[model samples]
Target: MSFLRRLTQAFAPPPRAGLDRHLAMAVLLLEIAAADFSRSEEELGLIRKQLLTGLQLDASSAEALLSRALDRSDAAISMHEFVALLNEELDAAGKRELLSWLWQVALADGRLAPHEEGRIRQLADLLFIPHADFVQTRLAAGA
Candidate 1:
């Protein structure tokens, strides 16, 4: 190993492997829910349901995961790190499904704020979700 590399490794703890995919997913969903500057009970409930049913996590585990996600989201510099991790871990269909979840969270308050839609659109771009798929997910969520 290079001398500087060895020195850095010796002094600094190894970086985390990366954000966990489930945590990344949760954080994204939370971000979408909060994009409007408010997170309603409905929005947070949908997110909690996603964690509970989708991941089959127990109530306690789901709550803990959500708590961690909130912490990560608050400290996050950009969504790129979460998106990059999700892109590496999730396939195309999975990304599409995640978009759907984001839409649901956005609409959970029964209105789509401009900023909420904008946030989803930005994430759609990062996830490489076609505009058609983005619209489809929005339609599905509204339906």
Candidate 2:
């Protein structure tokens, strides 16, 4: 590598490496939270908890990631790009598990709004999650 190029790379922010998947998952969750046009504290809390637990991230890291993910979700034109990334990165079981977590977020507000339910269903289809498994996850989430 050229010395100047190497120096530039060294001075640049370190790559997040493997965090893209985490951020994509976070974006999906955030998308669901915002789907109803009202984001509840309950849902936000659940999203933070999931980011920390599911991604094994420290609190600060999770917060930072979530903040970035919110921006990405806001700028997103469609969920297809994020869902495509997930499909490439995760196995069937992993995808199913993510769908379950999404359901948990959807149910966090005590009652599921129609828009929330529809968003979940749409995401489930995008992720290639079967309807049976989607229902099973919804039930498991106590929705």
Candidate 3:
């Protein structure tokens, strides 16, 4: 019974809440991960790893955050909401770091899809990150 309950809880949707900066970033990452019209295991795994490492979340918290990110991603009409939250919350260095994470996700499959590049470009512009930073992150991510 205990194991079953834990398993059930693991699959359950986390409570909906206002989007925090971290969650906003996750939504954007998910968007980038799916930009190529397919969500490869590689992209998905990188996302989880980023959330765990970047956000310093425990496994369960990362899972819950990913759950919420998926719901937000599915229901989103545009990336504006997430972008706006990040714009308000992140500094220049923070934006650069976020872009690096996005680049990492975009390159997870060992290639950069055109759509993924487009999405990342749009996000960088929206985040007010300079072109140099964008290019630098892309290059650093192994292109």
Best by lDDT: 3
As a TM-score, model 3 comes out at: 0.87
Residue-level lDDT of model 1, residues 19-110, one tens digit each, is 69899999999999889998899999999999999878999999999999999888887887788889899998999989989998998889
When summed lDDT is taken over every stretch of 10 residues in candidate 2, the lowest stretch is: 12-21
The clash count for each model shown is 0, 0, 0
Global Cα RMSD, each model: 3.1, 6.5, 10.9
List the lowest-lDDT window of 10 residues for candidate 3. Answer: 12-21
Ranking by TM-score: 1, 3, 2
Per-residue accuracy of model 2 over 1-143 as CA lDDT, tens digit each = 99999999989854444447988999999988888897899999999999899889999999999899988888878777788889889998999889988888888898888998999999999888899999999999898
Per-model TM values vs. the true structure = 0.87, 0.85, 0.87
Instruction: Name model 2 segments beyond 4 Å from true.
Output: 1-19
Candidate 3 C-alpha error for residue 133, in Å: 0.5
Worst 10 residues of 1 by lDDT: 12-21
Model 3 agreement with the true structure over 1-143: per-residue lDDT tens digits: 69999999999755436879989999999999989998899998999999999999999999999999999998988888788889989999999999999999999999999999999999999999999999999999898
Candidate 3 backbone overlaps, count: 0
